[model samples]
Target: MKLFPYKPRRYQEEIVQTIFDCLKDRKHLIMEAPAGSGKTICALVACLSFVSENDKGIIYLTRTNSQQKQAIQELKRIAEKLDLKAVSIQGRTNTCLLIDAIPSLKEKNMSNEDVARLCAARKKRSLEAMRGKEEWNRCIFFENFLLIKNELKFDRVVAAEELVEYGRKYKICAYEMNKMLAKKADIIIAPYIYIFDEFLREKFSMLYS
Candidate 1:
């Protein structure tokens, strides 16, 4: 496939074929390979091949935030050869700017749900303020977002950290930006909690499913 991006390493073609076959047959696959065996790229090529023709999406789950980097790098290479848009998603606890800026929110050690609730309220107020209701406090980061949202693009593979830094520079909420990007992503790279947690998984599924 054009998405492979490089000549196959030893057994790499076999790995790709096995995965493609499993996906085509609607069966489960378990692949065990040594480190540096091109497994990551193999899986990307195989899945992209299927999804490109089938009009589907891919959700690549990693154990930790760090593990997402390698998969994103490999996916970037494949994207150069094929048309694709991808996003690395992270939770609000890592990407919310208000929590860091407000002492009370930061000192309380809020859970993810708490952070989500606060963010939702702030966003609601931001919208309400935009619609001429000036009674509620607005999230400044989201205010900045309204200024820059039209200029934003996610045509390439965007790692979560890189997006976060971009949001920092623009003074927008990275987590909210991620949600907007997720709506258009062909492949989504996220941590396991996105699948293991029922609430988050439902939200994630609604984005790309």
Candidate 2:
């Protein structure tokens, strides 16, 4: 699929082929490549190729935002060679505008669960207030999200920066948009905690499975 700009090294090509073979055989692969080995690009190209061939999706679990950015960048490069849709998601704490705007939550050093609870409480209040109103005054971002969700597209790679910019431009919650996008994204990039943390793992499994 002309996955890379330059010719791949023998080892990189081997890794790519091995990944494809493992996927085809329905086997698991554990690979460790040292820094400067272009492991990121190799994995992206190989797995993306597999996904396109099989009409499946890839959930890329990374450790940090920097790693997510790296993966997204490589995916962007690969998108030039193939039609791909990808999205990078961070924890709600990093992407939630409502929680960020609440001083009390910040002062209390609220946990993620706490922040979620408080945010839900606020949203509930807004929803109740708008029960009889002609206009909506809830979280505008979330409101806009619901309004435009049916028209949302997921046919191109969407990095965190672009995701945030889109939400800001449309007044939609970036965090919510990411969740919705994940359902249709060919590649879903997220922190390891999303798949490792007990509570979140179960929740996301239910949502995506």
Candidate 3:
């Protein structure tokens, strides 16, 4: 895969290479670099190079949607440079927004004719897809998110409530992966609670509960 030419400053190169080496060795890394150190790019380089194909796609969690978008954008920039495809998994509501542009409301405002027309158009296009594609789940999650945002805008097609319904299905927890990856995640990104705060751990327990 191609890589970005934005050379790491004199110091970050070591950190980047160290991260790459640690991941190659399957060692857990908890690195902290100051601003302008290309943390995002370095992380992607390590993740893209080292992650196994059979493992779950890179999971990047953040407190705010903006940070998640920032990470996704940086990964995309690196991917474009390297010609590697990336994935992003988010809340289900966001997924619903991807399915349709308009969030559904209990009250109907638009004409029934227009709603029928939109549904018909989507069905027609949906059928145009390649045969056997319906059974395949090939699109990367993050790529799917981008398509919903850029191509469709997610407001008209997805119902907000339905999106909320799938929130629990995609969450990642350390305890869950401990039996699998020993708490190691490919490009794992989440809040501090999952790491330092026991309360956060218990909250996630309830989520599983």
Candidate 2, run of 10 with poorest lDDT: 129-138
Q: lDDT, candidate 1, residue 183? A: 76
Higher-lDDT candidate among 1 and 3?
A: 1
State each model's CA lDDT, in order: 0.86, 0.77, 0.44
lDDT of model 2 at position 172: 73
User: Which digits, one per residue and each the tens of the lDDT, describe model 2 over residues 1-209?
Assistant: 37774678768888888888898899999988788898888878888878788888899988878888999888887888887778887766777766555575566777788767755765665566557654343576666676778887654878766777777676778887777777778889988988878999997887666
Clashing pairs in model 2, backbone N/Cα/C closer than 3 A: none
Measured by lDDT, the strongest candidate is 1
> lDDT per residue, candidate 1, 102-128, as tens digits?
898899999988988888889899988
Candidate 1 vs candidate 3: the TM-score winner is 1
Compute the lDDT of residue 147 as modeled in candidate 1.
73
- Deviation of model 3 at 124, angstroms: 20
Winner on lDDT between 1 and 2 is: 1
Q: Lowest lDDT 10-mer window, candidate 3?
A: 173-182
lDDT assessment of candidate 2: 0.77
How much does candidate 1 score in TM-score?
0.93
